[model samples]
Target: MHLSVENLTFGYGSKPILKGVRIDGIGAGKVAAIIGPNAAGKSTLFKCLAGILKGTGNIFYDGRPIEAFRREEITKHVTYLPQEGASNAVLTVFEAILLARQFSVSWRVSDDDLVTVSETMEALEIADFALRYLNELSGGQRQMVSIAQALVRNPDVLLMDEPTNSLDLQRQLEVLSIVRKATKAKGMTTLIALHDLNLASRYADQFVVMSDGMVYASGRAESVLTPQMLEDIYGVHAEVSIDSHGQTVVTPMCSARNRIANRRPEYAQLAV
Candidate 1:
């Protein structure tokens, strides 16, 4: 097993949010997405996987309990990039990424770590802005730096929160493309918490939708993103259609009350 979490249960103080969560089927080279509304425990679940926050039940990576592993040990295997606001960085882009060496196999970075960092920067296409201060960069640029730092660890599992929060449509898709290509190239596993349904459907190899602090559905995108799911989770009626290219699109329609009020039954019959 690449990574596995069996029966993960966690909460704040006495309030339970996640109960008996199991994630044993994960494998290498797949990008898994965790999607939910605001305050639906998405980030909490990520912290549990990262072992930054403690939780009940089994949480394993490479067939070992994650909590049992040393912090440095786990750091070498997994990396989590929280949202941009959490970054207190005053360093330049290159400097911030170089800090990733702190979690190295050795206290002092070997030649390999240096090479990895350089290569990751290149792969992320941030080689040009390497010397720029993170705060001075645009939101999109800052996010790229953050990603470069996370990937510099060369981890087996990567967890990202709102990876496309501050980006244009082109940059958003560019980042997603980079993520997919890199993870596949390295055979690494990735989990991203996202809010955009269209992007999630387009990119994620697997989808886990959370509702009311529980998994509403977990499966392939086509299997998971049903019209009923939209209705139940988003509280909207939508028509789900797939084009000839097999890409699914959700066309959310107005509610029944609005539709009825806009088109009176008697008036419609007379027009016909």
Candidate 2:
């Protein structure tokens, strides 16, 4: 499957948020990182793609307009894991994941569904919390359960917004590695909204850099995460280099404002 968005324009009432956003395409079995500074509309873009928010534009799955499909039909092919997970649900972790597998079922829970849920929990290292209620778990645990829920659905496209949020460094690496493996094994088109540039560079096959509700850059992380882009878009004086593992490393030296202020006395007030 191929995913593409063109001329996407969305706003909150009269205030525009996304202005003519366009992504050429993301092929199946690939992970694309949606990266940007705060308020760049990364989360909003995920909502529109998942059909949680209706925006004016063309969203196509394999050249077919998403608007042409019904809500239920769209859900079958796309699954979205939000940044802040829902903890209000009273269901146990196992039940919640099992329920997610019912999107295409006919009330009867098959052995395959049970196996999928159990395997997903195991894969996510959350099987121990199977009987625990969602409300009882900590923020990080709930986030893991939320990831399990999305994966059990077996969707063609997965949209994960900050899936590593609240997780420790080890869990961050584990989760992303597992997600990348799943994308390849299932041929799933995955897009993740990430603030950690280094992590995105390590895991993502492609990068979609967002800025002020628009695509500032999109391509390989090595090409997009340039020092110039860091200074211009992120307002940082950064050193971009490749690690021994061939991952792009971005080390921020200082704020662009402070750099200018140090050289030009007149701009000191702005930095202060």
Per model, how many backbone clashes are there? 0, 0
Off-target runs (Cα >4 Å) in candidate 1 are 104-106, 255-272
Instruction: Give model 2's TM-score versus the native structure.
Output: 0.95
Query: lDDT winner among the candidates?
Result: 2
TM-scores of the candidates are: 0.87, 0.95
Displacement of the residue 226 alpha carbon in candidate 1, Å: 0.2
- The alpha-carbon lDDT assigned to residue 116 of candidate 1 equals 82
Error of 2 at 37 (Å): 0.8
lDDT of 1: 0.80
Candidate 1 lDDT, tens digit per residue, 209-245? 8776677778888888787888778766788887676
Local distance difference test scores for all models? 0.80, 0.92
* True-vs-predicted CA distance for residue 182, candidate 1, Å: 1.5
- Candidate 2 per-residue lDDT, tens place, 1-272, comes to 79999999999999998989999999999999999999999999999999989899899998999888898999899999998875668999999889988875467898999999989899889999899898899999988888888888989999999999999999999999999999999999999999899999999999999999999989998899999999988999999999999999999999998887799866766668
